[model samples]
Target: MQVNLPTNLLRSFVAIADTGSIVRATDKIFLTQSALSLQMKRLSEIVQVPLFRREQGTLVLTVSGERLLDLARRILELNDQAVESLDSVGLNGPVRIGIVQDFGDEILSGVLARFIQLNPGAELQIRVGHSREIRELFATHLIDIAVYHSVERDEFTVAPARMVWLGDPRLADRETLPLAFMTKPCLARDCAIAALEGAGRPYQLIVETSNISALRVAVEAGLALTCRSSAFTGHRLPAVELESLSLPTYFIAVMTLPSAHAAITGLAALITEAIENIVSPPFDLATDCPIKETEDA
Candidate 1:
């Protein structure tokens, strides 16, 4: 008989690996601790090997579990894709959206995938650049909706976010820190500089480019330290803690014209939902989202 692992088991396994705690994974998988434990037990019986082991009072994946985790993600991804594709509607029309690069690429990818699956006929035109440029595009009616990072809570505040220093470990050893950042109008860069200057820390700009990828490369290569929203920082460019480097809180905002279409509103809601999911500590999806009116043309 061919061995078949249930989808729910894979989901529970992935949640456990991602969260590192069965208790935390319970909230994500919506399973009681005992129920999730049963699922894991069933998975191990199917695979005929222990999937996870305890280490320092935390759940750590066994070697077999590590290998299975990759397969599990791919399977779940395909499963989700097929379901969405089959359920997609034939809604059509253009929906132009502008977003800043930092959190835009990561968060919006999943959000856009869902939106596109639901509205298969909708033509999406995405413009990625500085938040100021994106705001200009929306102001000129060149885009239907705009999402960007900002320090101001003026009208477009979608949710509260924060800028944090991220760098390779070796960067900390240097007396004069090397910094990587984009051009002007970058909130992370501004916050990073403000904190460093306020502390009177010595630093030099080693990489200055408008490309986020370049900044990431510079940081990962230990060329310089870069700052990004806590939403965007990860194991690739882990957050670096410095006693003197206190940064400012950043905000995610959406801009829409006065007479925006229904699609724009729908997309805005989807984007807000996506942000809430990715942000740490979970922002209130309903209360934090305040739709601000754009200035008249």
Candidate 2:
């Protein structure tokens, strides 16, 4: 029997295995949930065995799946090495990219450094700001790529993150919710305010800044509860319980203009891979009991 497995399918499978959910896996795979699910089904059919199983309500690899995973990693490593050894992929060129403030941390720095190492000749310009700012840069054709959050899902969406309120749980008991968020023109701020208003919860904005570190500081100080995406969840700060204020999921989108050069493709792939590698899974409702900070937000 001659059955050839596609590298793309292998990559998606690896992503799912690493992230433990089709949804989180799609963040790096760049496939819609339905499409990713189809790929999983197809991959299972090719192997003629069940690949995944539920254990304690969480999806995990079966024994057969584990065996396949070991082989998949080697295959992917060899395939990627061969592709890179070609060295004439046109990955070197000037590329301008804008990303949201939340990603101004090690996530962006590490990826940018890696991209520069891979394509030493490539000139890079990075802009970090609110999603609206990044979108504007992309819209004006001032940037080749844009990373931002959006309510609408499109071909560019790489990840869908649940909105979470992170801070001292004690703050939630206040008569008026106190908020510390990014300044105006920010999606998190707007959503937090809207959710509060809709819930008829009176709130006061105590701290406003464009810096995520500042927000974390305020949250750490028990100043206020700040709204953030699940992408920022791997910290010690507790997720403030507030069923009255339900936040919406925001899609982390990436936009790259059409280009003949592989620079855009290479950079975009690195960005998604970096994000998937760094972002911890979204907060679990069961863990209202705050846990230790595993990583910097």
Model 1 lDDT tens row, 1-297: 898877668978998999999998754554589989988999999999998999999999999999999999999878646544543344355567888887666756688888888777666767778888888877767677788887767667877765678888678678898888998988777888888899999999989998877777777777888888766554355678877888876678887766555555777888877776566544443544334556999
Cα lDDT for residue 99, candidate 1: 82
Give the alpha-carbon lDDT of every model: 0.76, 0.77
Model 2: residue 146 alpha-carbon error in angstroms: 0.7
Worst 10 residues of 1 by lDDT: 282-291
What TM-score does model 1 achieve against the real structure?
Answer: 0.62
> What lDDT tens digits, residue by residue, belong to model 2 across residues 1-297?
799987777878898999899888654554688988899899999988988997886679999999999999999888756655655664543467888877667566588888888778666657778898888878867677888888877778776667789888988999988889888888888888898889899989889887778887788888888998655544566567797798887777778877424666777888877665544553222432223558778
Residue 149 deviation, candidate 2, in Å? 0.2
TM-score per model over all chains: 0.62, 0.62
Number of residue pairs clashing in candidate 1, backbone atoms closer than 3 angstroms, sequence gap of 3 or more or interchain: 0
